[model samples]
Target chain A: MFEVENLTKKYDGFTLDGVSFKIERGYITGFIGANGAGKSTTLRSMLGVIKPDSGKVRAFGLDFEKNEQEIKNRIAFSSGAFDYYSHERADRVAKYYSNFFAKWDNEKYEHYKKVFSLDGKKKVRDFSAGMKVKFSLALALSHGAELFVFDEPTSGLDPIARDEMLTIFQDIVADGQKSVLYSTHITSDLDKCADYILFIHEGKIILDGTKEDIISEHTIVYGEKEQAATVKEKAIGIKENAYSFSALMKKSDAHSLSLTQEIPNLEDIMVYYSKGGKR
Target chain B: MSKNLKRRGTLCAILKKELFLATPLPFYLFALLGLMTAIPSYPIIVGIGYVALAIFNSDGFRRSNRDVEFTCTLPVERKDVVTSKTIFVVVIELLTLVFGVVGALLSVFLSSPNGNVVGLDPNLTFFGVAFSCFGVFNICYIPGYFKTGYKSGIPVLKGTIALLLVYSLVETAVNVVPRFNVIFDSLWGDFVFARAIVLVVGVIAYIILTVVANRIAQKRFEKVSL
Candidate 1:
């Protein structure tokens, strides 16, 4: 398990302000946010790939700054932007990567490579995007990492591959000892497997909880467009067409009680927020 | 410091990886560079190759697509990243110098003039000048590249300018200026004691410059978003 508290980063036009979250062991936490919502920034800063202006991170009962390499040894991190060493063969990259961690197991890497159908002699470019992700996971797993932090790992992958990745994530945490945290715009993937959801928007985490809890708390109320004015002010967010309107709000705060209230899925929640929250 | 001993990988791991990733050109070029030293009437441009090494590392052929990001994911510190690359540069400098001395020895015994036409003679003092140039290049290039973690072109350009001035001014003062002739031939061109003083001062300067460059590069790379 890991926790990041009050992580703050500032750039010229954007600021990730007081962002904080914690992930429990034995769960896949889906990080859903619109593009440029500070998901990658938070992940990089958490792993110390980039330094945050200020933050406190604790993982496996160790402080990040005080025990970076020790903590990194326990965590497997990959981002979509990571595709260096493409010209090198998988075995060679693994050999180089293996030297860094005392727990690195070549056998496990060999096993995963076989399972992923990755040729050892092939360069990274020879593999598909999905295979590349699996290759990174193979290296991370061989290193005995307890926490897997991936940024948009499923992006550009076909649905079948995405589903397979979800299954692999489940398998990783099956022993109730490991954890997986992934950020993606694909909410359907989370609906199928994520036990918990952390939604970030505009550099802030707007909502976070168990998937069931988050879904149960919010509902989408739909009605004729004529009735939109009545609910617009009360809805967390609203999407209105010329014919009908769908508004998201907490069930308790819902004013259009007579209207049909549909259970909002992860995508619905994300879309509603993206449409503009609290309007 | 107490926790450092507990870390699994040491700087050795990072250094090994660097060599594995870097091009083999510098090693092969070292010997040829020494041969360049034996060419009479040519300027001792051995430092030029080292300058080219900095530029080579910055481009697509030497590194491609988010190499910095991939490196950051490894079980290493940001400080280690800068330190390892700096060490790699220093290793290249060492190799070039070793071959240079070999070439200087060949020049002394084989009766070939070692590029004294327009610069400092291919002597111990020539090594001093090369060392000083590399020191300036390290400060300008290494830290400059780490500022954004991907831009090496400008740093190399600045380093080229700085080293050019050093190369030209030193070459002129020693060869064209009549005030400095004893260091070149007082005890045989490459063996003069005065040349040793220049050599020692240049080595010390290189050490100081390289260390300072490492510190600046580490600080800049830490802030880069990678």
Candidate 2:
């Protein structure tokens, strides 16, 4: 339902050059990138919060510029940093938000408030960072949004909160009418919650596809230096530790059973690709 | 309808947030009116009361909140958010005018002996000036709001410094030439025209600032990562 096409933005020190991606109506798309990789810029352009220097963004098949308000009603977002209204209590903030958003579900807000065990009367600024992230998620979900765009939602949370958030995200996408674009440095979260992974590096998308397609299409190989000759020119980075070495190869070219071993993880592949498939 | 058009509630949500931020200004209006009504002179009381209304609302334009970052994320257009805030300032101006006039009229009625003649026309000048003051507030505020979400030190600091410079310039001009006031009084008949000019300038400036502010908001919002 969301399409970001050839989006470009420029700053004095950084640039997001012709980035493009699409999120299907129901799948969770994880935007994985390192710091300064333009992931956030892509998200902002998609939301039309920042106008791309060039190219068009279509949400629900309508141009974002022409139909910004209409499209916004069905979308919710939580920022990378877990900040909230410092002076207002959590319940008060929720109530204030309810007045403007007709779709806001008070019951859902209340339910999540309880689930997260947030004290309704406490000012948001008093809450810990993890608590703030939970509150932000609860608020986003309570709005009954069709799309959830989270910018590093798991940044400051404890492990338990992170696990709980992942569970909540999985449940959120179960309805199939809902979609998400989760941008984060946490590779593990993508493994658990994302269906499609888009890897951004140096302001461009290096690789993007379903988890299985990426993992299945790539294989990890290891042995002596002579085996490197048999591998494709694009070896996805090699690790050398004293006596042995390991390298990743395209699975289509390398027979898995014949290869020394296979290691599959989003992080390994990202590191492999970012290093220009060197081995 | 396009999917985006089908889901347009985000703008209202943004306006709601702005309204909460602005609601406290009206209380200042009431307090200023109460203080002014206690004064014995009707015309003077009325004129100053109107000025107080403008000033009270101006105070609301003083600070900026960084929390605007949160609001910018919801699916609302930046223009809509700017429009909502502009509408909010207009509402505050109107409410202040109503309260100032009522308070002035009541003080005149209560304190005057046997319905003595008192000039109510000058109060219209007061209204004009107050309206202009509200206009100035908006002009300064809207642009500032977009630049820093009122949180960063730059926009507000610049506004404050500019306002102080303007205030000093006006004060200096008023002190320098008695001839200027006499000439001004002849044209405006005791500052009515001056207040009217200010009111008009304020409004024109407000409109121009709003358009600029709207564009700035759109740009800033799009650049916002979250």
Candidate 3:
């Protein structure tokens, strides 16, 4: 449903170089990267918030530049920063945004408001950080959008709030008619909800595949220092101590070695790949 | 709704939001000051003050990081954002002018004959000066605001300086140059045709400046990275 091709943006000290990825419908795609890894930059380019030096972003089979209004109408974007009208109350915000979207559902907004336990009469500035994020989610879900693009939606939330957010995300895609592209540093959140994973590092997409495939195919091996040296040529993201070492390797390769092999998680894969591990 | 209707809805939404975000105290205070002043040029002062207040309020939104968040996440085109802003300014300018005219007329009628109350003729000149100030402000402020997102302090400062410089030049021409003085006197004299021509030309200039400013702002804002 969404695709980015050769997206490039250059700053004085950083450059997003030839980053590309595709997100399909009916599932959540986790855009995971470390700080300054260009995840936010890529998301901004996809939304036309940041103009790319060279690229093409296609969403819902339409070019972003040519069909901005239509494309934006069919998608909802939210950020945890919540830079919207902080001085105003939730009711006022809803009233203003309601006019911009023809598909804006008042009932859905009310439903989410109750579910989130938000008071419409209170100024947004007075709300807690978690409340602000919940307010943003309420707005995003009320517009009947086919795609939801979020930037660090779980960053400042408490454990319970984060869990609720993840559950809401799952519920959003439960019908298989909508999709989500969520960019976040919280790999554990993705392990619970994301179906596909796209890992970016230093302006490059280091890995892209199904979450299960990436986790099941890669093995983390722990062995003696001498054994680590023998397998160093084939290992990825090798970490060493005085007596023992651990490295990431393919399950196929781990069978040949007499070392303890363990299945990896999203965080393990991200750590290994970001540390120069092979795909 | 249809496409045009949706576009209009979006514009209205922006206008509504801007109106709510901008504090009206400055506009009201300046308008009240203009109403109480005996000076014939109070309208120009008030108009310029209104422009400054608008710029300051817009910059406040940017400083607080609300503008990017509000505008970028909205389901509207960048051009729509520019258009709505320009429309808001135009509406405010028109309201200011109307209030100025009413205050001027009231001052003329209420003051004693011996007092320093001005007639409609002098009030017309004040309106002309005020209109010119608005034109210059629009030319400077809109494009500058668009190019820099919402950090419009520099643009507004430059616009005010440019307005004063242009006004000083015009004043010098009328006072110092003989030929120009003659033309100015003719225009200022009680000739209905000349006054009508000046009014028509001023209206046309304001419209042209507004259109040009909107176009430039739209183009610049389209390329702006949020």
Best by TM-score: 1
TM-score of candidate 2 on Cα atoms, chains taken together:
0.75
Residue pairs with backbone atoms closer than 3 Å in model 3 (clashes): none
**Rank ordering of all candidates by lDDT, starting from the highest:** 1, 3, 2
Tell me the tens digit of each residue's lDDT in model 1 across A122-173.
8888888988888888888888999999999999999998999999999999
Instruction: Give per-residue lDDT, candidate 3, residue A132.
Output: 86
Point out the higher-scoring one by lDDT: 1 or 3: 1
DockQ metric for all predictions: 0.67, 0.33, 0.57
| lDDT (tens digit, per residue) of candidate 2 on A1-279 | 988788888888888888888888888888998888888888877776555788888888888778776677678877664565566778877786665565888899889889888888998788887788788878878888888898888887777888888887888889899998899888988888789999998889877889889888887887775565555465667765556667767776667436587757898887776766443
Score candidate 3 by DockQ. Answer: 0.57
Please give the lDDT score at residue A164 for candidate 3.
89
Report residue B95 deviation for candidate 1 (angstroms): 1.5
Question: What's each prediction's clash count?
Answer: 0, 14, 0
Writing each residue's lDDT as its tens digit, candidate 1 over B29-80 gives 6435645665555565754455455445534444564666777887788888
Candidate 1, what DockQ? 0.67
lDDT of 3 at A123: 88
Evaluated at residue B139, the lDDT of candidate 2 is 52
